[model samples]
Target: MSTRRAFAAACLAACLAACLPWYSVSAQDVRANGQKQPPVSSRGRLPVTGCAGQPISDIIVITQPPFTERLPTRLEWVRRTVRKTHANTRDEVVRRFLLMKIGEACNQIQRAESERILRAQPFLVDARIRVFDDEAGGVRLEVETRDDFSMIFEPTVQSKSPLVRGMRFGDSNLGGSATLAAINWRDGRAYNDVLGVELENYAFGRGRNEFRLSAQRHRFGQDMRLEFVRPYYTDLQRYAWIGSLGGTREPIEFRRGDLPRNALTVRREFANVGAVTRVGPVGRLRLVGASLTREVQRTDEQSLLLTREGVIADTTDVAVPTFRPQRVVRVNALLGVRAIRFVQVQGFDALTGAQDVRVGMQLGLVAGRSILVRQARDRDHFVAANLYGAYGGTRSFVGLQAVTEGRYDRDAKAWDNFVTSGRLAWYFRPAVRQTTVVESEWSAGRDMRVPFQLSLADREGGVMGHRNSRQAGARRLVFRAEQRLVVPTRLNIADVGFAGFAEAGRLWAEQSVPYSISTPWRGAVGVSVLAAVPPRSRRLWRVDFALPVSADPQRRFEVRFSSIDRSRVFWNEPRDVQAGRERTAPSSLFTWP
Candidate 1:
């Protein structure tokens, strides 16, 4: 009845016809059968197949001479792009023709040198050509063609350039912490806020080759702080030296978050030097590497004997001079084989091997696949057996882990047993249909205690039902589901998305703790909405909001919001309640970070 309906009907009909499996004999075949037939071409080929074996008759005319340029351009690229691949039949030929035009347009953007040559030779205007012949050998088609062209000017390289500049800046925040297995925060507060900016230049003039640079300020959280790394080497071989002059803050060694709160803040100036080498994708794989950084800290006169609270009676006072060894050695090596694409069997070993001699080794297969990816279909999956018998982290035990990324972040921490894990995800259309993901992790090993409650009570200050020597073997299973909604691109922002999730887990630690992993096979469900906010421009924005109903006693309910920076109600800004009084959870945390 209407134009739109009529168009839809036409499209449907065309698609149905194209998809049908139909074969009809050609007129020539019919004729040879003594019925009736069409006339064959003079050359014993189809009329459309004229010049099936001859060379080109016309020259491929071009207006300019092709020359090497800093980047590619449009015109010279147009000639180099004629695809020789076969377009099987009539329909395919038409489709390939259209695609070739589109490819030419893309080349116009990617070929800078071609455009440069065309500009230099304004006399070279447009291009035209014709195919001379095409022949088939078995299933493949071979094409022959030719063209003539001309240009206006000669090319030159501006190698006399004296200098080039490079600069970059980055900022990051470490906003949450887990003490053992418990979240640590009253109001959400970021522990690490770091921003770094650097500017340097490369001088490429004759024999005077070396990098000369300087900088002002840089700092790294409460632990390690430094202002700059000047006199740094840019050479690619062995024995390259770099120097730095800035204030330094050393990180506490040989401990997890298990340290006393009465720690001293020591500050001083320092310098560092190092060297490195690699054989493959810089960040993906490596064959050999070593780095040695030494920092000489400066300090005013100070005392060394540290005392504990209230239990001290006598005092020894003296202004004793102090200096600390702020030096570290980090060496890593890869043996056998290593690469990004091909399978490489490799072994890695690293050691700081000093006072806090920490050694770690991981021997496992890291393969790439399209498992649990988002919209695009490819990612990394690793089944690894990692061992960390360091002062920090838990003591010695070989652990197994199976991890998948690009959809969800599974167990980053290792488990001390054989573990089986899987994740499934689908990225759906935004605004209407949303993405859904399901994930699980299961493990079996020697017996150990599985947590039920992180804190025994607000007054007890310990875990609930905790045993000193609990056997650790069990079939632990955790299942999680997540659904994400992409905020409509038709809305104010394009990249923002929302999500809702639920998690349930159970562990069978010998029939006693069966059907439950931590506490009563607990499940929690929550929803989140996101908005985009660009970092540098106020015009571009990103924002996300989430409300979680958690079974963890300490965190019964949570409301989270994030933009360029993140903020949460439970961790950043916690709502306090009376010990015995129970009230309905509030809709939001109005005063949180």
Candidate 2:
């Protein structure tokens, strides 16, 4: 038999064995026998023990330090000293997130919602809620949570001398207040140096609104932003709003055929404000909203043009296009409907921690008109729409989504800058500790703006082995498949796993000014070593070794490392929607199934 076929056979056999009933005495069986069991709970542990309508006598919050009493004797001093320096999350923070209150009837839905809220906090490692029979004829509620080491300091290194290229340092839970403060510094090649600062508060005020501010400065440009939002914290929340102001002034490098040809300085400033309100029932919701936005952009071609060699070049000889300064003010109406549900699972995205999987359907639409325009184009009408649906079961899940956006120019009598994209994904679990995923995506653009052109790069949905090879285009398609297995770990500090993946993609361009077409299909196969620190962090650290599926002797293997899980396409929780932007369907919808 061939080597690849033999490997596949071995994997199949292992999966079959893992799916069998290996444990003779399961947790449910032990409970049936009236035996004392551990307090630890697994994913989706609902409060269904016939305590749904019981009155809550008292509410208790228990916060655990990072290091517990279950350590070895020799490390007692180390654990004690670390605990003394690291502050545990405050009880008030946990209490404010709870939906259940004392003296009120304990509802199972409220208890489940409260647990999900606590688990979503950045400082929390895990959270659990339990109900007990009270001595005074009412049920008592307990909220138990563990804290993570909130301080982070990561550095980027290179193989050459002066190894350190950049670094990021931050505190995710500043003073146990659930506030984030971070700073980043990078050694830029063309820009000389870069520095940035960011601050965010998840619970800003009495209403627990969110606030964020960021600023970055480099030799070539600077960016500054400020935002405040009051999001729907729960499925039944009635109203939400957001406001933001930001601007950017940066040098943009124009490339052709994957080679830098010219550069120009572009300046842009924008202000936006929006609001949304829920109008339908609790399980299925209809959202209505509106936004007003103003934006201005300008290009500076008079500035010295730099060529690929970093030498001043004549402006007349440059091949890059220069857009006229423009200003636009727009008002948009938004509408959406959603009916979604969540299920907690393990060994899917994270090796050990529970991951919330979202399932159901959502649809959204945004229609707007430019009320005012200056300098360049006449008033235009724009529209955007998105649709998403998913189905998740015990052993399998399937999801599909599509998005389209475009604008109609009144003067040109044609569509301008129209773009559309779609994605389909499927996940299957044959064993308790194993998962397999297959995903495909495609995107196309017509009359696209220069700065919005697409590219086939690692960060832009391309093969890992060809990350450094830039293949720009107006249309792209990619297919990916991966299999993951989690290994048992004896240590409590970390969880380890392994993954094997394959990817293939191609790109095509119509107008060749900004990007060139990549006619040949590129493919890669790779293996990854995955590990998560503190086990419950829900963040994977990966090291990948990829090789191109080609016979070219010039191609070599590539090694890449990343902290983000790029393969995860869907999330259980809704992402925060930015002001003046169309809400991402399914991901930003608020509803319960």
**Candidate 1 lDDT tens digits, 1-593:** 34334334433443343333322221121222576343222343222332233332211211111221212343434424311111111111111111122112222111221222111111111112222222332111111111111111112223354222112221010000000011111111122222222222121121111222222222222212222221111111122223333333422111101222121224443333332243444213332322222223323233222233221222333222232222211121211122111111100000000011112221222211123323322222222221112111212112122321111112323222123232222212222334454545444322111111111111111112121212122344555566655554532112355567776544344432212233345345666554332101111122223222334433334333222211011011111111101111111101100
Q: Against the hidden true structure, what lDDT does model 1 obtain?
A: 0.24
Q: lDDT for every model? A: 0.24, 0.66
Candidate 2: Cα lDDT at 116: 73
Cα-based lDDT at residue 365, candidate 2: 79
lDDT per residue as tens, model 2, 1-593: 34334334433443342233312111111233777444333234334364578889766667776655444566467667756666666655677778877889988878887787676665676788888777567777777887767666879899997799998887666666666677778887665477777677777774446777777765577777677877665665688777887777776654354344455677777777877898888768888998776767777755354543354754554355555454667787878787877676665666666656668888777777888555424477778887789898758988887777877877678876677777788889999878898988887766643244455453546666665554556677888899998888755556788999998888787672355565577788999998876665666788888888743233457898887532234522111011112222222222222
Error of 1 at 161 (Å): 58
User: Cα lDDT for residue 318, model 2?
Assistant: 38
Clashing pairs for model 2 are none
Single out the weakest 10-residue window by summed lDDT for candidate 2. 572-581
